[model samples]
Target: MSLGGETAKATIAKFAMAAVGFFGSILFARELGPKAFGGYYLLFSVTKLADRPLMGWATASKKQFADNETKRRELVGAQFLFNAVWILIATAIGLLLADRFRSYSGIAMAPFLFVVLLVSESNYEAFDRVLTASGRVGLSTWTDALRSYLTLPLQVFFVFVLTGYAADGMVYGLVGATVFTFPVIFYYIGTRPAVPSVDTFFSLAQYARYSIPTDFFATLYNRLDVILLGMLLLPAAAANYEIAAQLTAPATFVATLAGSGLMPRVSRLRAEGKTVGQEVTNTIAFSSIFAVPIFFGALAIPRALVVTVYGPEYTLGVSLLAGIADTVYFRRRQRH
Candidate 1:
């Protein structure tokens, strides 16, 4: 498919995922209320922070897979090994710090749930990068949409139908959805594990050396605020900040779409000795068109938007939405 077609499909999938996530967030916030939802968000943020290290390898694998098709199976095997080791180490660290995490997050099962979520999320990230790297950008995005759509009903079932699970139910629902989708992702990639080559490890390491620190700081920059609020203040405070952040999150969609679709295309073109100057230029122009309006629109109606969508209880951080929207707009520009 042409780049335009691939991006259009990806955009549709992302829109669906965003719509589902937006409504799901509102439902969880209203049903769980501020405190429980905040606790869940706090744990969610922690998993994001913990998963940063894997992102380096995931990003590198995407680039490597796109650049060297002959080594695809080797890259997959090496990444699988790396992820397995990382999960074990991360789980051990979480266990060691279990008590501290519980006290800080104010959730008794935070550490245990963290381990489950960390593993599931890491698996999803790995698979997502692999699919995108292989140039199935639309399929990659559809998998994400499937996960989002599946997660909401499962969360509702666990939280309400099962009774008493609350925030923990949300975690279970997320993990279950991810696990359920693995077979589809696996079938698309269709590579059985080969013996990992030593050369492939070094090749991945070379790319990851630069990507790792970039992923780490990016994760920290994006998530540190919520982490701090959850730790320093109450979960409700963190929830307020999260509400503002979520409301402004869609501003970055254009940039994300450009990045996701362009990277593999650019890498492949470079591998074929083709210049990508025009592609990059076109993406920048396209992103700017949508970004400016979204930024201003959010600034204009922060309070009413929040109240109507998430209800009045989430109005505490209405003032922060404009600033957060601006931050998201600039961040997207910087990334693009």
Candidate 2:
């Protein structure tokens, strides 16, 4: 598909996912209240940090898969092996450190649930990257949408309908959604793993050498604040901060979606010996159109938007919205 077509589908999928996520966040916040929700967010942030180590492999896989069609299956096999080993090692370490994680996050299920979350998140990310790298951008977007849509109802059932799960219910729902969606993702990708050669491992590792540090610092930059808040302050503070961050997330979607579609296109264009200067310029220009307005809009109504969307219980985060919005805007610009 053309970049425009892929971007349009991604935009639509993002709209749907954002709408679902907006409602779901409200429900989760109201239902669990600030303290519980904060703990959940903290646990999630920790898992995101844990997952970062594997991100280099996923990043390398995307570039390699896009550029080297002949080696796609071997790349897939290598990535799968690498991810499996990482998950096993990470999960074991997490289980061994369960007590510390539990004490810090104040979530009783942190130890057990963290492993499930890590596995699910790792696999889902790998599958999504494969789809995008293979130029199934629209399909990949819908696949993500599928997971988001599935997660909400399951979360509602686990958190609201069932008894005693509480914030842990959110984790359960997410894992369930991932389990249900994997087969669909597998079917679409349609490539069985081949035996990866020694060179496949070397190539992936060489690329990951650069990608790992980039992924590591980026994940830390994004999640470190939440992690620090969870450690140093009340869970409610972390919860409030997370709510503000979530509310401002949409501001960067245009740039994020553009980049998603741009990468594969650029890879192909470069392979074809075509100049991509105009394409990059046009994408950056197009992204600024929405990002700038969202930044200002957030600045204009930070207080009202917070109390209205997330309830007065979250009013403490009102001061945070504009700053987060500005960060989102700058991050989008920096990304381009």
Candidate 3:
């Protein structure tokens, strides 16, 4: 547990993931353009919300079985069962709401596509919590980040070369990428420690109860503005808002990586009778030092980047990017 080793690995994963996400965003934005990009963003947001039940079960299972192998396995099984129920329930709601709001701005998916997409996405992602609880954030972060990067070439080719379908191509690329990596992920899961059992599920009731609001609040914090923009502004304006906000996603990813890496070390230090106040201070000081400059720089160059990088049509809301950049700063500050 050399601090230097942990620090190096975490830094590499953080910057590498952001770099990949950055280039991928450019490719994706170009492929999607404004209109189709907006639709893709909206659909992804909705599907993300639909994933909370799976997330809740995962979080509960991970926490409950953090130290127990048999319990962990049972918890995983229950997580799948519970997630299935929610997927079914959400499918029914999607059928009704989609028919009623076929022309809606933010959510224009087919009757059951929302549930189907989220279920597929979440089922794989849910294991992430388990990995994290097992102190495998190192593995989780690097694996997922690498997976995202691996998906980008195909996404670029499929969206631009084979099909000019924009958002559809983007979604297909995602599903296609996940499909390709399924075996690798499952193999990794198998190699990791397992705690297979049924009773672990029943012991997790309390943790599941607490996970609901945490998941909802976290989702809303990240996405409430998108929902609000769709309702309050014109569709075009809302699309602009989404692009602006999404540009800060890399910043969010960086902060998450930093915080995740630091927290466990800080916790261990505190347990070993060291005061965490200095660590907290150092974390904030260093984060702000690196983060502030990048944010301001991005704010200054939003329009040029949006136009030359994404497309000319995306220049509709330069101010919004700067605004969202500040949002990321404040968000990091508050969390830190």
Candidate 4:
């Protein structure tokens, strides 16, 4: 399959993930009382933010990974190592600060931490990275499909049927789902593992370091709201906000897919000593044009969506999310 074609398939897979996320958001709101939901959302958002330490390494990593097997192994292995470290540190800090945290769910913190640190799920990006770099487009798409579509239904089942406690059940489902990605990533790496020769380790670290700050800031912008909400509002209030955000997930997948696909291609052009002007243009214009509608439409009728999906109890934060959607759609993402 062609690069764009493969990327399109990956985008479809991401939409499936987005569907899971979209539905998962509603399921959690229903299963947990708003308060518990709030706590869970806040925590999940923070844990997600911690993942930013890897920065956009997935994108840059793909660049190096596209070049050589040894380089790929070292880059991926080091990134995996770094992701583990950051996830652990963040989870520990979350635990240590629990009592002080207004958004603490009564649920056990360790399980969520385990999910955050899961090797299989956490390294999922590596699969697409390897596939994109290797030009194995269609296979790359399948892996994402496996992760998203396959895992989503199971998650819904857990949330709606098995446990019915959104926070716990959703986490259980998500953790279970992540197991599917590990095999795909390993397989993508093929026989020649990205083993870190000492040189490669340094290469990995340097690359990771360069990408960390931009991702950190970008991630913080995404999750910082949840953290602040945990501090400022009650959990249910936070959850209500989360509900509005949930509606945003599916559509945002388009931007994500665009950005992800654009990166590897841009890297290839650079490799061929080509200017990446069009690549950057396509990524930006498309991301902006794509993200604008979903974001604004949600803002236009946030309360209706929230109330319809999660029940009337979720009405309070609709306006806030609506405002946020409007602000961010036009303001924050126009540049990149």
Candidate 5:
């Protein structure tokens, strides 16, 4: 497929993921109720934060795979090694601070759950980025789509059938979905593991220098509010905030697709010694057309939307939805 076709496929997949996630959020809220859903949201947010280091390596690996196809296997194996080691360190830290994490997050299982969910999510991300960067975007998209679409049903089974533990059930569903989708990533990574060398470490270090801090602050910027809300307020408040944040996902998903879809194209333009300013301009202008409607719609429709989708109790989050709606632009700007 051509670039436009690939991008359209990714964009469609992202939107489908968003739609599935939005419905899942509603089901979670309805089934778990506010307090339990809030705890689950906290679990989700913290795991998201825990993904930073893995995200950094994944971002670097994506660039390496896109830029150096011959080295892709080595790059993939080295990254796999790095993440395995990092997970061990994180596991030790979680064990040592298990009690503290329980006290802080108010979830007795926070430390254990965090480690399990983080490892699963981190591995999924590492593989996803490599596939995307390697131009197997359709495969990558389907992997993500499977995970996204499966979460709701899996959570229903776990939460309602197997366990009454709402938050834990959700975490279980997430981990399972990720694991179920791994074979696709594994197949694309191919048959052999590339042995890591001093050169592999050096390359990873060079890219990490640029990607780590970028990922760190980006994760914090996106997740800090929910973390703080969890700490400072009742679980209901955090759940409300989660609802608001999720409602803007259509906007967020579109913004992400715009960025990810255009990165290689932009990089290619740069490599060909072609001026990219016009390309950037065209990207921003095209994105703004869709972005404007989503942003303003979120701002204006939050109350009705919350009531319609999540019921009236969630209506309290209307302001929060409108406030963070502009984050779509922030997501877009970072791609530049």
Candidate 6:
């Protein structure tokens, strides 16, 4: 497929995934109610917050893979080691403080869930970066789509249909979805080799010099509000903020798909003595096709969109949604 076609495919798949997430969010909100669901959202958000550094490693891995296909295994192995260390350390800490964390977030099975979440998230993030860098854009998007769409059905079965606990249900569903999608990822990347050498680790870590701070700030910027609202305000407030964020996810996903497709092509173009500046220009133009409409639409009908999609209690976040769209717009415009 052409780049435009690929972008559209990824974007449409992401929109479908977002719809699945939207539905799941509604179920979570309605079934658990705002307070409990807020606590659960906070728990998950904090887990993602902690994983930012590891996620930076994954982002760096993408760039490294794009830059040098020969180093794919070494890059994958190094990141595997990075995530393994993080998983072990985080699990230990979460186990020791599980009760305290659970009390604060009202998330059940906190320690066990954290371990599972970290493992699943690490695998998914690593898989995504590798897929995108390898130029398997379709597969990359599909893996993410599988996780997003499959989790909702599994959660529904466990959370409401089978009368299981909502938090456990969501966590289990996430694990299951990631596991279900793992074989394709594993097939693509193959197994991690033996533990890489110290030199290999450092080389991989070097790439993260750029990714680390960027990922950290981006993760914190995205989640700090949710975290603060959960901690300092009501859980319902946190839930509302999450709803607003989710509402803006498509625009962000568009930029992500474009960037993911762009980098490898950019690297390849440069190698072929082609003008990468033109490619970057083309990508921004393509992404803006979606970004511009979404931004203006959000500004025009934020309340209608929020209320119609997420129900009335969330209408208070319409302004937040508009602000998020503005952020999305500026970020896309400034992206290289």
* TM-score of each prediction: 0.96, 0.96, 0.83, 0.83, 0.91, 0.89
Give candidate 3 misplaced runs (Cα > 4 Å). 1-11, 105-113, 191-199, 258-286
Cα RMSD to the true fold for all candidates: 1.5, 1.4, 3.5, 3.3, 2.3, 2.4
- What TM-score does prediction 3 earn? 0.83
What's each prediction's clash count?
0, 0, 5, 4, 0, 0
Between 4 and 6, whose TM-score is larger?
6
Considering summed lDDT, which 10 consecutive residues are worst modelled in model 3?
A: 101-110
Backbone clashes, candidate 4: 4
lDDT of 4: 0.64
lDDT of 1 by residue, 239-325 (tens): 888888787776666567767778888988988999999878867765765567768987899888888877888888787788887
How well is each residue in 25-125 modelled by candidate 6, as lDDT tens digits?
87787677666777778878878877878888888777777777666777777877888888888888888888877776777677778788888877777
lDDT of each: 0.84, 0.85, 0.65, 0.64, 0.77, 0.78
Evaluate model 2: give its TM-score: 0.96
lDDT of 2 at 32: 88
Per-residue C-alpha lDDT of model 5 across residues 67-99, encoded as one tens digit per residue: 776787788788889899888987887789888
Error of 4 at 59 (Å): 4.7
After superposing candidate 2, which stretches have Cα over 4 Å from the reference? none
Worst 10 residues of 1 by lDDT: 282-291
* Residue 308 miss distance in model 6 (angstroms): 4.0
For model 3, residues 1-336, the per-residue Cα lDDT tens digits are 443344346557866876776787777766556666666666667777778767876767666545455455566667667777888888778777785434544334434445556766887777766655544556667777666776777777778898755666667667666666655555665533334344455567667777867887788778877766655654456667776765666566545654544544565565578777765555555465445875887767888766776677778768788888887888778876
Q: Model 1 compared with the native: what TM-score? A: 0.96
Error of 5 at 230 (Å): 1.4
Screening candidate 6 with a backbone cut-off below 3 angstroms (N, C-alpha, C), the clashing residue pairs are none
Candidate number achieving the greatest lDDT relative to the actual structure:
2
